[model samples]
Target: MTWKSLKTVLASLVAVALAACSPTPSSGPEATVTVFAAASLTDALTEIAADYERDEGTRVRLSFGASGAVARQVEAGAPADVVILADPIWMDRLAAAGRLDEQRFDLLANSLVVIAPVDAAASQDVFEALSGGGRLAIGTPESVPAGAYARTWLQATGRWKAVQDRLVFAADVRGVRAFVARHEAALGIVYRSDVVGQDAVRIVLEPPPEEQPAIVYPAAGAADGGAEGRALLDYLRTPRAAAIFRLHGFEPVA
Candidate 1:
């Protein structure tokens, strides 16, 4: 080959090599924030995650279950970055175990409601509605946060002892809803968020504050996690998140 032609070919080859080495546009900022949260937070969290990804260019994967179950998962070394729980107890346990940072916030609050099968009569008296062998579904006391709240509510309302025999324990609030939907149970208690858009059952009663424990959802970041987790924790405290929470039937923590 002529020297000039050889030089030109080599220059083109070098240009191609250099072009290959240049960084292409990033596939957006890639991040995996594993959030273990209460199942009741599903709708709100999904919406918040979409908004967060749009602004932060990160992906959020959420796992929803009972708060106590999530705490156990974290305790077992699950690689969760953030935890949003339906109650403070589980969050406190993780913080006490040094799994989560001391910084935590009560993100939102919710109320309890008794749901009945679609054909059930709408009664003015909440407890009396469940009389005459009404099968009640609630979360198991050991692992479900909502079950604990329901029990507390029942006890405070003086119905726990009367209704104990009729109680059918479920693994989680979702399970309780499922049981209620299937007619395996005539009545069940679940978070207000869970009953929205549910056509199989009707919300028969909103538990009076005197009959229920106030439901609070708290969030915290992993103690040893990076900025992504902390950023999410901070973002959850923003007014934007509060608005979203309110939109999903939660009471904003202000």
Candidate 2:
């Protein structure tokens, strides 16, 4: 081949190599949805997020904490697409502040239980357990829905004032469980769902229906979440997500 022909062939080979190294354009725009959720909903939401990512090809980012804390974060302008709170009061605060969209509803329900370390003597009597002269753990009522519900139960059973001096406050229900699991607190009040998969602690008592507070989890889309956020909110109410919530010991609201 002539020198000119050889140069032409080299140029073609260079073009092919560059084309091979260039990044291929994606078929669709990448989508990511952020969800701020209550601590009690952690395991269930995580599994649901994984399923959503797998089925919808949109990434789901989850942030879990006490319901009031999560609501405060949203109020402080956190970048969240969806918000799932353990109480409607927090959701109401968000709605009042215009942080949430019009799409909102009760998502799940739970029950309160008293738990103790696995090795501790199982006592179904709430008063007897507290009379043992050890600290009782519970979430902080100021910012944790679980704590508020626990307080309600205690008051309904006429034990709130009696146990005030023996209370150990935690930031969330998980923290309460951790305290009991480690034997730091002799007993703890937490949601039934928080005890799932936890071998270190066992529920000792579930407050009767009359003494139990109404526990509800409310979910909403953020005002700025737009279409992607709305889609995520809708997906959470589907049958697939409900099954996961049930598996985690939460009752999905119809």
Candidate 3:
């Protein structure tokens, strides 16, 4: 072969080898991560997810719903990459079920509060407000952590029985807020974080710190997650994410 023909044949061989070494379409860039977080975390996580997306150049698909409902979805094999919940028990359950990574930690803490409409003169006293008039709104004890905490506090204070009859249960903490905001209930018990930036409602009372049940959010990587999910999970532990949580009224785990 002539010198030019030899050079051309070598170049063609190199091109064929390089093509063979390339990854297939399925092995190319990673897909966006899908995260399931609690309803109360909607605002803060949305901001955090945006920052994560911008910084990592990986898209994020966030899903916010009641902790229990979201937990059930994850348990049932939903294609979630991360799970953050208002209730730790569900996280524990998810971890136990092999749906979540074994390593999980408390993301933040919150305090419970009693709230009343901005226009109403509701008493700060739980028993007085419940016994004196309209329905009391709280999350259903079986599902919502906020409601469970509220009930535990009322019982601890020896006030559950007196107010049980007047209690109006909702699906979750946010639902309780809706009831109070709409005037459908005279009083509501919610997380301190949930009441922030509310123009239609005012916090009436909070239990003494020593007496309050511990309210914490737990987060973990999903068992079915990939490198992108793991990276986002690490980002959530950074000071920036903690700052964003604090800005939204959450107390980062100390």
Cα lDDT computed for each candidate against the true fold? 0.86, 0.91, 0.87
Worst 10 residues of 1 by lDDT: 121-130
Question: How many clashes (backbone N, Cα, C below 3 Å) per candidate?
Answer: 0, 0, 0
Q: Identify the leading candidate in terms of lDDT.
A: 2
Among residues 3 or more apart in sequence or in different chains, the pairs in candidate 3 whose N, CA or C atoms overlap within 3 Å are none
TM-score of 3: 0.86
What's the true lDDT of residue 130 in model 2?
Answer: 66
In model 3, state the lDDT of residue 59.
93
lDDT of 2 by residue, 8-38 (tens): 9999999999999999988886899999999
Q: List, residue by residue over 177-239, the lDDT tens digit for candidate 3.
A: 999999999899988888878898888887889988989999888999877788887888899
RMSD of each: 2.9, 3.3, 4.3
Residue 146, candidate 3: how far off, in angstroms? 0.8
lDDT of 2 at 84: 95
Error of 2 at 220 (Å): 0.4
